[model samples]
Every structure is written in structure tokens, then in C-alpha cells.
Target: MSDLYDNLKRTVEDLAAPADEQEAMLRKARVGPDELALDFDAFAAAALNLVESGELSSEAYEAVRALDAHLVAFSGANNAAEWTEDALYHSSNWATARELASKVLSLMG
Candidate 1:
């Protein structure tokens, strides 16, 4: 429905997508010296969507932003391993999201 969603879907589709499109997604998410920012576009969009849905608190949203920033800060760095570890930090943030989601569902019930 949105550009980020479309781009993300194409990425998930991977082998099913046209070769050129898949390559494009990989290129966007690829690490390189010329890169100016991390490619967390899909992850950020999905997280914001949930926050916009009123399922997560603003503080939780900020936590996600912080994690994104942590990874983005390494955009210009040459170490791929550090970038990957920062990206993996999403797991802990997802746990926070799950806790928020549970609270929202409890309130709903």
C-alpha cells in the first residue's frame, strides 16, 4: 500500500520477484563506502505502522528509532560485522514491541 511496504514485499519475495527488482532491493540494503544511511526502511515502516495503529506507546516507538539510529550510525563504517550485530539488536526491541502489544490486547479485553 505504501512505497516502503511495496519495497519490502519485493524484498521478501526474493526469488519470486524479477531478477532486476531483487537485485535492486539487495543493492539498496547492501553495505558500501558510498552509502550514506542504513537500509532499515522496511523494518522502520513496519514498526511505525504498528505504532500508528495505537498498539505501541510513543516511548516504545522511540526505542525502535534509537535502535535504527544505532545501525544507521555505522552506514559509513567498513565493518560489516558491527552493522550486522546492530541490525540484530532488533530482536530485543521486538520483545519490547511484544510486551506493548500484550498490554494493548489486555486493555482491549
Candidate 2:
């Protein structure tokens, strides 16, 4: 399997480890609050590699799909929030979208 697949497998396994260990492992991998956004191009390249290699099982693929969906929603909400804050004078819709996006981004971390 590719290194990306190996890394993903290890991360998934680490997530399933004992509670304390899992927490520690996650903490190590987690990006800081200020660095929550991923480089979607890089993410897509890695994901495509996994798919092309058939390294991801169906369950893993499903999880990846869910992650992708979350990323998209989070990005949209984030952009909306930024626009509202910078140009729209903090509209309620922008605030609400930002709040929701923050929650989703937190899950990724």
C-alpha cells in the first residue's frame, strides 16, 4: 500500500486506541485552531492516490466522502463568514454560517 494509505490506516487505528492514547495521538495530529483549513488540492491528490491504488476499503471510502462533504460545507461557511465580517458589517446570516463552520472545522481538528 502507498504511504498515504498507511498513514490513514494508522490514524484510523490510533483513533480507535485506548481513550488516553487516542486523545494523545489525536492531539499530535491535530492542527492548531488558527490552522484548521486544509489545502484542498493536496487533500484531493492524496485521496485520488488512495482510490487509484484501491487501498481504501468501502468503509474507508465512505468516511473519506463524509470528510470531503464536511470540508466543502466548512469552507463555504467560512468564506461566507469572512465576506460578511469584512464587507457586510456582520450580517446575521454570516454570523450564523461562521458559527456553524467553526463547529465543523473543530471536528476536523
lDDT of 2 by residue, 8-104 (tens): 5444333223334433543586732112224332343366567667765544555555544544553554555532213222344333433443333
- Residue-level lDDT of model 1, residues 12-75, one tens digit each, is 2332233344346556877431221223335454766755766555665565455445445544
The global C-alpha lDDT for each of the candidates, from Candidate 1 onward, is 0.42, 0.43
Residue 39, candidate 2: alpha-carbon lDDT? 34
Q: What's the number of clashes in each of the models?
A: 0, 0
Candidate 1, residue 98: Cα displacement in angstroms equals 16
Give every collision pair in model 1. none
TM-score, candidate 1, is 0.36
TM per candidate = 0.36, 0.39
